[model samples]
Target: MVEVRMRVNGAVRSLEVEPRVSLLDALRDHLGLTGTKKGCNQGACGACTVLVDGERINSCLALAVQYAGREVVTIEGVAADGQAHPLQEAFIRNDGFQCGYCTSGQICSAIGMLAEHRAGVPSAVTEHLAADVELSAAEIRERMSGNLCRCGAYNGIVESIQDVAS
Candidate 1:
């Protein structure tokens, strides 16, 4: 077992875990933060997505030991004060989820996506490389492609993201 210390949801969490354990397992099993779902553990589904240092990453693909000293934010972290994050409220107001299995990951991914866009990051759909990228519907859809909603909630998801982005 190796000792790993990471700030999770604004709290310091230290634990000894197997080097091979994924951050997803550590968070759910060790810390009891089960909001981050474990879907398609191969990292394709994005259901285990979490914010590592404010960037969205598949927790299933990241080793717990590798996250030492980093900040990890699960779905539980987004609304630390009990009042929902804007994205969360937007998701609810927009009905961005159906079965709700992928809701947490979608929300987390959207938060990171918005941050990236605000930081002038361009998606593949960006029309021009040099010009400021517009958060067009296509751009939002392209940027959020990594997160799939099996329940066919894409419309609502995109709408919620757009509402928050605006």
Candidate 2:
């Protein structure tokens, strides 16, 4: 077992985890933060998405020990004082999910996506590398391709992201 310390949802957490333990298991099993779901248990699915130091990553692909001393944010951290984050509220208002299994990951990924856009990070669809990328529906869709909703809620998901981005 290896000791790892990380800031999760604004709280510092320390745990003894096996070297092979993924961050998803560490959060769910060790820290008891089930908000980050486990979908494919591989990098292909975004259901285990979480933010590490403000960047979105698949918790299933990242080992807990690799995240030591990093700042991690799960869906639970997105809200404040029981009030939903704007994206969360937008997801609800726009019906961005169904079955709810992928909602948390979707929201978390969206948060990072927006932050990336805000920082002027360009996507594959981005035109004119020197110019600010437009937050068009296409851009949003391209940037969010990693997170898939099996319920076919892409329309609502795109709408929710557009609502938050606008």
Candidate 3:
């Protein structure tokens, strides 16, 4: 087992996990952060999405040891002092979920996507590479395509993201 230390939700955590252990397992099993769901257990589904160094990643595809010394944020970390994050509130206000299996991952991915847009990162639908890309529905959908909601809440999800983005 390799000892890995990471800052999760503003708290530093240290745990011993096998090198082959996924970050999702390390967080859920070792650290007891179950908000990040394990869906697909592969990189295709974004159910295990989390923020590492403020960037969204599929926790199931990332090795826990690979994130040593990095800042990792799970769904639990998105809120502050029991108050839900604005995006999370937006999700609720817009009915961004149904079965709720993908809500956490969606919220986390949206958070990171917003950050990327804020930093002027362009999506496939972005028109000009030099200018700040305005987040149209197409852009949002394209950027969030990695995550799939089996409950078919795309409309509400897009609306929630648009609400928060605007």
Candidate 4:
């Protein structure tokens, strides 16, 4: 077992976890943060997305020990004082999800995507890499391509992210 310490949902957490344990499993099984789903354990699906130090990652592909001393933010940590994050509100307003299995991951991914864009990260669809990236539909789609919604909610998800971006 490896001892890992990280800040989760604004609290410092220290736990002994297997060196190979995924962050998703640690969050769900050990910390009881079940809001992050596990749709595909192989990381093809972004159902296990979470923020590590403000960047979105496929938690299923990341080891718990790899995030030691970092800030790990799961979907449960996205809200503020019981108020939903703007991206979450946007997702709700835009009806971005169905079946809800992918909602948490989608929202978390959108939040991280927006942050990346704000920091000038270029997406595949970005026309001008040197300039501030605009939140175009194509850009949003490209950035969120890693996340799949089996319910066919792409339009709504794109619209939600666009709404929050604007």
Identify the leading candidate in terms of lDDT.
3
Error of 1 at 118 (Å): 0.6
Tally clashing residue pairs in candidate 4.
Answer: 0
Residue 131 displacement in candidate 4 (angstroms)? 7.1
Better of 1 and 3 by TM-score: 3
Task: Name the runs in model 1 displaced over 4 angstroms.
Answer: 128-134
Cα-based lDDT at residue 94, candidate 1: 93
Off by over 4 Å in 4: 129-133
- Quick one: how many clashes does candidate 2 have? 0
C-alpha lDDT values of all predictions: 0.92, 0.91, 0.93, 0.90
Question: Candidate 3's error at 111, in angstroms?
Answer: 0.3
lDDT of 4 by residue, 1-166 (tens): 9899999989999989999899999999999999999998998999999998899999999999999999989999999988989988988899998899999999889889888888778788787654354578988899999999999999999999888777
Tell me the number of clashing residue pairs for each predicted model: 0, 0, 0, 0
lDDT per residue (tens digit) for residues 88-152 in model 1: 99999999999999999999999999888887777897765433445788888999888989999
lDDT of 2 by residue, 1-166 (tens): 9999999999899999999999999999999899999999988879999999999999999989999999999999999988999999999999998899999999999999989888878899887443244488888889999898999999999999999888
- Candidate 4 achieves a global lDDT of 0.90
Which parts of model 3 have CA positions greater than 4 angstroms off? Answer: 129-133
Error of 2 at 154 (Å): 0.4
Q: Name the lDDT value of residue 61 in candidate 3.
A: 94
